[model samples]
Target: MKILVYGAGAVGGYIGAHLIENGLDVTFLARGGHLKNIVDKGLNIVLSNQEKIVHPSYATDSLATLKNVKFDVVIVAVKAWQVRESATEILPYTSSSTLMISVQNGIDSPYELNDVFEARQIIPSVFRGICLVSEPGVVSVPSQCSWTLGEFQKNPTRAINSLLKPLIGSKLQLKVSIDEDIIKDLWKKLALIAPMSGVGALTRSVLGVCLEIKELRNMIEKAVEEIIVVAKSQNIILPDETLENSMGFYRALPYSATSSMQRDIEQKKPSELEYQTGAIVKLGKSNNVQVPVNSFIYYSLLPQELAARSDLR
Candidate 1:
């Protein structure tokens, strides 16, 4: 199967590297210095266990080159804000049967993809890993992670299995599972990530530090509760033990663990705040649920994000 991975950042680059390493038909849609680095030195991935440099079937920045090409599986691994832009770029190359994978970390990404592609054509998945682009064409994975993917409205189990066949046995420290209810899974992940990222950025502290502080830990729990309420209002009933389980999960994480949003905020780069905590606040408001904690987090971070964008432009 021909696969196209858009945005060769940390998550996309790492997944694409493993797919190429296992001899799959993988192409990367990259641009800027990353594209140049891939063209000159190939793609380099530093795994938690080892390192690999792979040259995939193709890598390109220009859409004109791929005008006639067709991709069976298109993994949209761009950030939440870039989903619409990425879809506009890749839709021209997608046939009706093309399985569009939403690998972003937000609730609206699936709907964004559905605007251009059919909802049934979208496979919503959650990426559970800490990865980043240390440099152009270089992806650093500091821990093992997994992807929980499933059909949103269409059952593409067979196609998903076929796509996952290549990485059956590799040292990538990755796992893939099919979730029967992918939307619920997405909400569950959001419960964990939104609070963690919000509090992480707001406090400018790592996971462990956030948990160690009494007030911050309490805020984190309240944020999770708010998210659960928001999810329930949308008819997605999270588990009763979700908050506790998520707290346990975060508590077990290393002391140095910080969310990517925190890193982006610290570096003065554009962040996924709009999709992360901001989504929760919007959903809560629509549901008439008061998410004061998340609102505080969202509003507090808004100016910094706006300033970052202004500086970039």
Candidate 2:
């Protein structure tokens, strides 16, 4: 199978390296420093159990090059903000039968993707893994990894098995669930991540840090409530017991674990304040839900970073 990894960051790198090992032809669409590094040293992926270095044919900074190319599947691993922009690149690489899987954070991606492509053509997928770009060409993280694929409508059988075929002898975790509540699951996952990561990123705190302040703990609880409210308003059915799930994950996760938001804040790079805290505010405003706390946290925490990214890039 021919595949293209549009945003070959940590998640893309992890999946691509394994796909290369499994003997499928893969290409990575990358640019700037990361692309430069990959061209120079190939792609490096370090999992807890194993390590991978794949040097497949690569393109540096151009999706138009993919215009003359063909791909059976295009796995988009770009950031949430980059999704629309990145999907545009796939126009050149995609054939009529190309399958697009959006394994992203926010719930709105599928609809956005469907605006350009058919809904039946987009697979609602999510990644339940911890991956970090430790350095250029090097993606490393601890080994609690999971990847799920499902159709947004109601069935997974038509959408997932062919994607699974490439995984027959690979070191990849692939699963197909027919859950009608995939969106709810995605929101539930975000609810957990946003509160934990948004609070942690805003405070520069870790999982262990949330344990210190009863007030912050309460704030975390409220942030989660805001997410749950939005989820319900969107007509997604969250598990009644879903509230504790995200927080529970925080407790079970490594104390030192930090979200991508926290990492971006520390690196002085652009952060996902909108999606985590910002999504809460955006969705809340539409539903007439007052998310003053998240709004306060987002507005207050983001200006500094906004000014900082300008200085850097």
Candidate 3:
């Protein structure tokens, strides 16, 4: 399988490293300083509990050089906002049977990429591995995280299994979920991440701190309820116990931990916020759903984000 792992930031880089470690056929698509580092020093991953050098892989920035190369799978790991640009740029790398996997966060990314290509051409999967790029080629993820795969249409057929075979058991836990209502599942996830990322970025604090504040806890519940209403309207049933379960795990996280979105916002780097909390507000308005908590955080964080960006210049 000729796999082209796009973006190679944290998540993409981590996945590529694992695939290469397992002796799978994979090449990284990266740019800028990350591209240079990968070309010169190869890729690196620092596990949550271990020393900072393990998996390795080759990388490059040239799509034209890989023009004749037909990738059996194209893992689109960039943020949602970059889907359009990435698709356009990498158009030549796709072939008829190329499985364009959407391993990004947010409900719209898979759909967004689908519109650019075809819905059937996309393999929608939720990756729970925690990854953050402290530098260009250095990627980090917790050792024991899991990844779930399912088609948007509910059937991860034989073809899907063939594609997932290489990634199944080598260092990453893979499961197949036959949930036809993936939209609801994505929304449920968004419901939690929306508030967590928003609050995390706004406060420069981790989830534990937010959970400690009575007011913030109410805000999070309120946001989840709003998302639940939207999910129910769309005919997706989410268990009432889901929120409590999510909160339990969230609060148990290390106090110093922060969302990748929060890290991007703090670093003044362009982030997936548009696909994170921003998507909720946008979708909520379109569906006549009110997401005040998310809206407040989205707008409030904008100025700080803008100020941070200005300092970069």
In terms of lDDT, which candidate is strongest? 1
Which sequence of candidate numbers ranks them by lDDT, best first?
A: 1, 2, 3
Candidate 3 C-alpha lDDT tens digits along 1-313: 7788888888788777766766778888888988777787777677766633433344677777664787888888887778988887766778776778777778887777766777777777676645677787777665455556656654545565655677666453323343345566677677767777888788887778888898888877777777677666667788888688667767766666677888888888877777887877787788888878888888888776667547434
Better of 1 and 2 by TM-score: 1
- Return the lDDT, model 3, position 141: 65
The local distance difference test score of each candidate is 0.86, 0.74, 0.72
Instruction: Flag regions of model 1 displaced more than 4 Å.
Output: 156-171, 311-313
- Which RMSD does model 3 reach against the true structure? 3.1
Which structure among the candidates has the greatest TM-score?
A: 1
Which window of 10 residues has the lowest lDDT sum in candidate 3? 172-181
Lowest summed lDDT over 10 consecutive residues: which window, candidate 2? 170-179
lDDT for model 3, on a 0 to 1 scale? 0.72
lDDT of 1 by residue, 1-313 (tens): 8889998778888777767766779888888998899989998888877888889788888767875888888889888998998899898888998989888887889999999998778989888868888888888888778877888785544565665455444447767677778999999989999999999999888888888899999999999999999999999999999998898878767788888888999888999999999999998888899999999999999999999889424
lDDT score at residue 271, model 3, on the 0-100 scale: 77
Note the residue pairs that clash in candidate 2.
Answer: none
Higher-scoring candidate on lDDT, 2 or 3: 2
Error of 1 at 257 (Å): 1.4
Find the 10 residues in a row with the least total lDDT in model 1: 162-171
